[model samples]
Target chain A: MATEAGDNATLKRKAHQGRPVSLMRKTVIHALLLGVCLVFMAPFAWMISTSLKPKDQLMAPSPTLVPQQCEAQIDGAWVAVDREADDLDITCLLVRPVGTSYSQVILPDMLHEGYELLQTVDATPDRPWAKVRERLPGGEFGELRVVPVSELRYRAVPQWSNYKEVVRHDQMKFPLFMRNTLVIAALGVIGSLFGSSLAAYAFAKIKFRGRGVLFVVMLSTMMIPFPVLMVPMFSMFKWMGENQLGTWLGTFKPLWVPMWFGSAFNIFLLRQFFKTIPNELSEAARIDGCSELGIFLRIVLPLSRPALAVVALFTFMWVWNDFLGPLIYLQNQEQYTLVLGLQAYQSQHTGAEWHYLMATSVLIVLPIVVLFFIAQRTFIEGIATTGMKG
Target chain B: MALKDHNTLKGLAFLSPWLIGFVAFMALPIGLSFYYSLSVYPLYDEPAYVGADNYAQLLWEPDGSGGYGDALFWKSLKNTGYFALLSLPAMMIVSLGLALLLNTRVAGLSIYRTIIFLPSIIPIMAAAMVFLLFADSQDGVLNAMLAKIGIDGPDWLGSEAMAMPSLALLSVWGVGHTVVIYLAGLQDVPASLYEAAEIDGAGAWSKLWHVTLPCISPVIFFNLIIAIIGTVQYFLQPYVITNGGPSESTYVLTMYLYDKAFQYHEFGYASAMAWIMFVIILVLTGLAFWTSKRWVHYQGE
Candidate 1:
């Protein structure tokens, strides 16, 4: 019994020793995962950081992620300082006669807009102060003040105005581009759902003579690289513009119109989903005097909401993010999508204006990121299902 | 027979939208592209017949001396091939490794998955902007980080030698989607196999080799084909970031085709190039499938 007790104590001791090892393992795993997460999130964080930075700080010798507030030399040390109120009178160090006493005095009727020296004055015993000028609130030059020489410095501040400047930039009309993109994406999603669902219903349920052959043909279109069709498609659209649409070249028509015809992938996804629904429901609806269209609208469509959501979400993302289509079709700046406008902004101002450029990029990507978060499940499901099937 | 005929008619009615779209969009363009490949069809002009000339000029052009005018076809092909070779295996390995790591029971796994996958969803143009900011020579965050480690970072997108590799690095950053797909594949691997391996005294590495790999080989094969096709048609990254610049070192085939068709108005030549790309993709895909039979193990097969 004593030996048994000793063994039990030893076992307890061993268990107690094992805890730290397991904890060490957990710590290592967490550290690795966190490290990987940091690498992945670094770029996005950089974008946001750059977007918040002031123009001067953007090209600093060593850029920092967090935007720093303005600093001023105070008491012989650089320190962050608040801007002097507009209503306050400007103060200056005034000298009376050469080698006389220096006094801190207010320059009356002068508001501190920003400090600059107009001209240096040679001081004599009679008029012993150096003359400096301060620019007032307006562009008008203020009277020169005779004062002792003092250093002036501007503090670095986060430029929240960069976002405004980006949106209202002269070259790129960001709001208009966003409107065009939204219109195209919305219509594309609607048309894709309307057209692809109809086709998917037919492919899933309707037993046609050439159904098998046609389905295979439609699926095969997914394999065709876009570059192969790019030339002819361009020619076709150009021809169509000249002949039918009265100039569809520099318009949003080409971007969304093709979507109205139903994409192959969407049709495949919806069809696969539609096939899983019990045939009895549609049959009952048909027996109850519902037409095929009626059965589709009332029975199949309502039941296939999740699948349809997946299609709509994915289509929305594709249309929103489409760069090549807009680049090929939209010639005029007014018809440019957000993606095209962002590219134009970057190309026009390559290295400089990074803050504004990043601001615009954030504007362009924010919606998609938000949408992904909201419909995260649908995205994962759609990707998983499509990937597995492919 | 009449009822069957009626059913066929109804099915055709339902299929009309896709049918019309297929003919107008897919079939017609495909046929027209082929015809355009064989003809000199500049934009806004009727195509002139030039049978096999475009093909011969592009394919048979000797280096530095003869054939087509300013033929960078071989150069672009080499660059694209180099990019695919470098990026494809790297992406697969990284994504697969991430997938395996995430497959373990860990805290905040969903958040980790979401964080990793987030980059893939960002628009390529926007992603390019972010990459450009981080990759800037002097003041870039990446260079700053490298400086802390006592190494000077090279100009990522600026230098010709590093341009394609920089794009590949960007590609790896957006492997979140690939990783997610791989995670799904890993999930489908039955736990019983792993348990059985463990019971048989198999270590972690051996279990991965013996059980995990074979089960997920099909997924890997699928991803490989997809990645190849994607890399072959790669356009937006180079277009947005490099614009096929620094002496056209990063110029892929698609960018070449885009320039030919849009910039230079060499529609026929571009069409030929597109067809060549199409054929290359087909052959590569076929090769992948043929090779998959040896290694891609299916459950219950």
Candidate 2:
């Protein structure tokens, strides 16, 4: 494919020969790309931001990406208070009048004798400091008070320890989940690389009576959604469990053991990659009296490192991010993967504490993100080939 | 014949692992699923043959005021249909546009590609958590941002009217995978084709319409088929984000099938539902391929 620098230069030169690309066009192109990137990247940024924030600010309207510590003085002591909307239309503010429990939204200018002036917030949700609470002797919250916006102190105090706290959480055995997930991932990657490569080698190189038919049959299987087989597969595993056939139902076997067979998608991908390697190499090995398996191991497998890496990475990813399989197969708490554990954590402790949930999510996704950076070219090429080479 | 037999033996030996897996996992299950579809297999007892009563009940009770077969069934089908209608085009167009932009000689292409690709690759469960936070009706970042500009945002997941659309919005956010595929297809287009179009005095828009789209039509077809198959069995995100909430507006086929199979333990009925989904995918994919003959141009074929 003419897709490298040479192709780019020739296309750019020939397509617009009379006029070079203008600054206006470049700026517009960049502007569009930036907007798209912002949409794509904002959720990740927000996820990490919400994860590191304190529980109090978890539901703050117009939440900030940065963790903030803004306080105001009420009853002569600084306290944290939730603010109303960041709308800056009206004059004056609402405060707990130091006596009544329910404070009124009042005009600050109306009270002449005991009223003090208060500054309007900076018209951004970033500066909502209207409410105040008393910081008691041992760092306990005393009361919720609506404070004047005046004399408010603000600082970016990010709760970077949320990651640590989530790990240390009682209900979630983060380390145990990590160990289980890694165990499954390791088995799955091994199964896929060995199993899919061998099958792909057969389909790509060897002549069989029904090879074409079998290959198409395998490709067609890719179109069948998991839901179609979800029930009967469950029944099959249940039968295994009922007959005491080596713990298929409630064990990791149901999840990772299937990969020891061929995956249609990975087999297809590797077969394409295998065919691209010259057939003469295998012939030369054959002439040297190498067996079929020996040629596959010594020549084909070593030469197809990139394809194997792609297969391994993809298989690892599927195992890591798998939800439905774990949702059904694994029964006990001790058998939970990170994704299942996260869902269980959410269902157990719903809504109020999102910091922990988001933090747990980030923890689950962090390894895949790291792998992407480590094998950037392989990941990109592998993904692109799956779609195009089809 | 002798040589063929020898090669066949070796090839079958190599493929033994996959062959064993297929018989156990796919072929056996599919056969049992069909058999179960005819019986009342509720896991507690041995499955009694109930004939096609499950299918009859599901289909006859169209309760047309609702989903595909029964009321909830029809509703699930319609909901999935509505989602597929919105998400497929939105992802295709946006990803194609972004791919075209990226295909141009741009500074910092890798940075943009990374940003775009990372979201699509993240765990769907994690992405759902983000959407859950970002789309909260009252205190969500989306509503808050809308409020800043003096427009109120709707209750995204909380409202029946907007729940599927909210999922669609999230779907668009992860269009990076499709974009990468499109970029690969675009780069594969020969530069000489563009040069020829230029010499023929075709402008940019005409050239894009005539030359570029035709070349990438197969990629589009592939994306459409994957998206359709995916949309018909949409789960995970809706399960995590909305849970078919706000009056079951986001109740999709797979979710209902899962509930029937796992929750209610009605393995037989769920198998029927699974077969229905299978038929839907086959018909839809068959339609795409049938239509592709007109629009999808294979250059060397």
Candidate 3:
């Protein structure tokens, strides 16, 4: 009985010990997961922070994730400064503090006008302080006081106007680019859905001669790299332009017109989804005297809403993000998509004005990110199904 | 029999749009591309037959004295190979590791999954722009962070040595799609095998090696071929970020091809390069498939 009692106590102790150990493990795992998430999100956070920075703050020697406004210590209270600059020779900055107006004075041997100071300083034992007569804010003359540059601090102030400036930048024409992208994406999505779904319906439902061979041929085309077709496609578009289309090279036609016919991948995806639906529904519809086109339109499409949504979302995102297509075809700035415009913006202003550049990038990426969040399930499922089957 | 004929006619009608597209876009382009690869056909000029000179120049020509020794073709191929060598393994390992961690019964798994998958959805152009800002030599976020640890960051896209690696690193950052795919593959791994391994006194490492690896081998193989193809055709990131600059360090095959076709108007040469890339991709894919029989495990086989 004593041994049994000892066994019971040990078992209870073991159970008691297991609780905190598991809790600790959970905490550790959670912490690790959080750390990984932060690493993954760090780029986006940096992009957001950079996008909100003003032009001047963007070029600061040490980059700050938060946009900052310079502040000066005045009358023992930190007051915001419109402009502050530290002289190369002196420790103090000539700051135009808030709540006071000061005139600029061109000092002797100074390249630019120096801001009038309020006080003067005598030479200190440790440092050699320059003595200069300067105009005060109230029009009084006094020696320049050397305030340490370290007294100035920067406070976080997001520049909301960066986005506005980026959009309004003369070279970018962001709004026009966005409109072009939307028109192309919308038309392309509609065309792909209509054409590919019809093809998928025929492949999935209707019995046809050479259907097997044709379907295999379509799938094999997907394996052919885009580079292989790019040259000839360009030539074909050029040929069409010469014959009738009137320079299709610089137009949106080359970008979206191809979609009006169909894409192999979309057809394959829709076909897969269509195959999963029981043929009995289509058969019954056929028995009900519905035409083949009517059966496809009414029966197959209605039942394939989820798959259709997947197709639409993927197509929209693909068109939105496509760079090579626009890069190859669109020669004029007016014809440029958002992706192409962003590239143009980058090349035009390389290594400078990153704030505006990042803002532009954010503008381009935000729509798709929002779309993904709204249709997360479809996006995940579409990607998974495609990867698995492919 | 009459109904069968009617169905066939209807099917043909339904397939007409795609059939026309296939002929106009795919079939014609491929045939013309093959022909273009053989002849010296500038955009404005009639095709003058060169008879495999473009292919020979790309494959064997060592000097421009023979009218086709840019040497960029071989260099770009090497650069692409280097990029794939570094990036493919890094992506697989990191994505698979993330997949394993995510496979655990962690709290808020969906949130983690979403956050990790977010980067993949970002447009490559946008991602390239963001990386360009991040990889700035002076005052870039990446370099600034590196300074905190007392290391000076190299000019990522500027220096010859670091440019390809930088591009590869960029590829690594966008491994979210691969991670999602691996996560799906991992979910398909039966729980019973893991339980069996646990009962056999296998530790976590052994269980992962014996049970998990075999189960997901096919998925890995699939991702591998996809990555290989993608790496070979890697154009946008380099095109946007480097423009194949800093002494042509980051120039890959597709960029070279684009420069040939668009910038230099060497349509015939570009077509030849495209054919070479196609053949390379096919061989690599075929090689992977051929080797898959030795290593890739299929369930119930």
Candidate 4:
């Protein structure tokens, strides 16, 4: 790992200092990269945009990335209004029956007997206005009123309430699920650190017959999909639960217990890193009559902290993003992780409650993105140089 | 010899955790799954010995009867295959393209790299939720943007033709991780090769095609294999976005296997399907390894 970083440092120097690409070429490349970056970020950007949008604006004919709040003069006061016209011209009546505080902008076609058109305002597209009307629903109605299309304002204030509401969603107990996910993730990381490192040390530093075969076997296990093991593992866990072997299926046990069994990917990464720690240090320790575990604890682990961190980061990510594992194992709603809770938030999705859903997604996604920014150097180059793992 | 014996004993002792885990958790479960495949193991009932019948029904049962065997099995497998065919190439090209772009000296290169790589690492489930908003027909951002250009976007996740492609977009967005892998490989490509190519009067395109590509072919190979392996188990999006609906156009193999096992309690059929999937993965990865001999070049080799 150290050697690779050294190589990259020299490589970065040469590539930058050597290349004399034309100014025109650099301009073209940067422009292209900027465009690509925008395209890449659009979904996430849209997620943040939608999460803040007012629920009414969610079904706008042409949605804007920024959430908007539009208000027009209604009943002689500037109040919230939804534009309903897809046209430049329409004959409408502004009506306020006696005793009603609000007024209604009614089109001629739907004009009722009691609601007579007191005045026929020939409302043009630009100067479209009716006498003081209602502050109400969206394009589901065609009542563009007192304020002109030009006069109506679109503000970009984010609705932070969506976050609050999504957290408070009845089925999605986000705090509870978050606690569940964290407990599971933290335990899994601890397990990986404990279990994978010990095994990786033996694989890298110890010599035993069939060790090569076992190492290869471990590498090949990384290729096996979760589906292949999903069924039998489920059956085993369920059986254990039935037999009172500490409640595997519904609790967090099934999620974290298997983590204690060293994973192929974590083991492989640690083995590579453990191989890098100089053998002379271990030989010196061995000559001092330090036991193998003693040497591993006293010398090897301290040097391999960065590698162990990468493994922990990766494990935390896997557990946090894991949908299928939680989907199958977690039958009870209260026991769900964030992923399953997000799934519950959108159970009846038809684009109606997208603001809430997006808010929940952002909450779930925020930690990982923040973590990446913090450890990006190690996370990027470490995973990059290692090249392949889960 | 005495020292070697002592080391070996300690080695075995240190590895006991993994060894026990392998035998009990991995090996035992794998063996049991195969055993369950040959029997009619309902969730509630004991396993009834029915040798080879599950396999026969899954492979040979015909005519969309939805009886003993689901004809949707074939449809789901085809969907998975379509996803692989669609996603794998896009992931490779886009990721490699981004990497090549990143490799060049640009201002704020780290920022560009970060932006490109960010999507790949976001929780897949979070990605699915975001895509749900993006692919939504009524008010999704994609269609809204499309409306600006006078192009009415199809219901991305709803329509039969557009569903898998919509999914491919989601898959492609996450290739930022792959780009980093390619970036590492590209950096490892010696500068001397490019200098030599430049002296030989190679144009930019020529240099990229001849010098750069061959150098990164091994990375390309590794990325392609992982992408293939990953695409075959395409689960999260379909399960979240579509649930294999709109005439089952997006029902991938893993979804069907999941439903059979957990939802419908057809554990035997699911296990049989799983084994078939395992074999398919082996064959595909094996084929990748086999084909690598011709295309993949090593530094020393």
Most accurate candidate by DockQ: 4
lDDT of 2 by residue, B215-300 (tens): 98988888889888888889998898899887999998899999999999999999999998999999999999998899999777
Q: Candidate 1 at residue A379, lDDT?
A: 81
Of candidate 3 chain B, the 10-residue stretch with the lowest lDDT total is B61-70
Whole-model lDDT, candidate 2? Answer: 0.82
* Alpha-carbon local distance difference test for all models: 0.79, 0.82, 0.79, 0.81
lDDT for each residue of candidate 4 in A1-390, tens digit (9 for 90 to 100): 122311221123224224676899899999999999999899989989888877667777778887886666556666655555343356676665545544566777877666645566567765655232244442233343455566666677777877887887776788999999999999999997888998999998898877888888988887888898999989998888788876788878778878887899889778877877888998899899997888999999998888888899999999999988898888888899998888876875556688888888899889999999899876886677567322
Estimate, for each residue in A1-390, the C-alpha lDDT of model 2 and write its tens digit: 111111111111112223356788889999999998888888888888888776667876557889776666666766554344333334545444554554444555565544333433233344334545554543356554454455666667776677888898878889999899999999999998878998999998898999989988988998888999889999988887788776687789988888999799999888888887787899998999999999999998998888899999998889988999999899999999999999888877868779999899899889989999999888888878887777
Task: Look at candidate 2 and tell me the lDDT of residue A89.
Answer: 35
iRMS, candidate 1, in Å: value is 9.7
Worst 10 residues of 1 chain A by lDDT: A1-10
- lDDT, candidate 3, A1-390, per-residue tens: 001101110001001111122666667767877888898898899899989875556667778877886555555867544332323342333333345564332333442334335433332344433222232343244423344445556789887777987888888899999999999999999999988998988888788788989888887776689999999999988988888957788888888878977888788778778878877888898789998888888888998888789889988999999999999999889988999998888888777778888899899889989999899888877776565555
Q: Residue B242: error of model 4 in Å?
A: 1.9
Per-prediction share of native contacts kept: 0.58, 0.69, 0.61, 0.64
The B-chain TM-score of model 3 reads: 0.94
- Which of 1 and 2 is the better model by TM-score? 2
Which of candidates 3 and 4 is the stronger one according to DockQ? 4
lDDT of 4 by residue, B1-301 (tens): 8978887888889888888888877898899899889999999777777998888888876546555455778899999999988888888889899888888986888899899999988988889888888888876888889888999889998899999988998888898999988888788788888888889999889989998899888888878878877888889889988888779999999999999999999899899999989899999999998988888777655
Question: Which stretches of model 2 miss by more than 4 angstroms?
Answer: A1-19, A71-152, B61-69
- Pick by lDDT: which candidate is best? 2
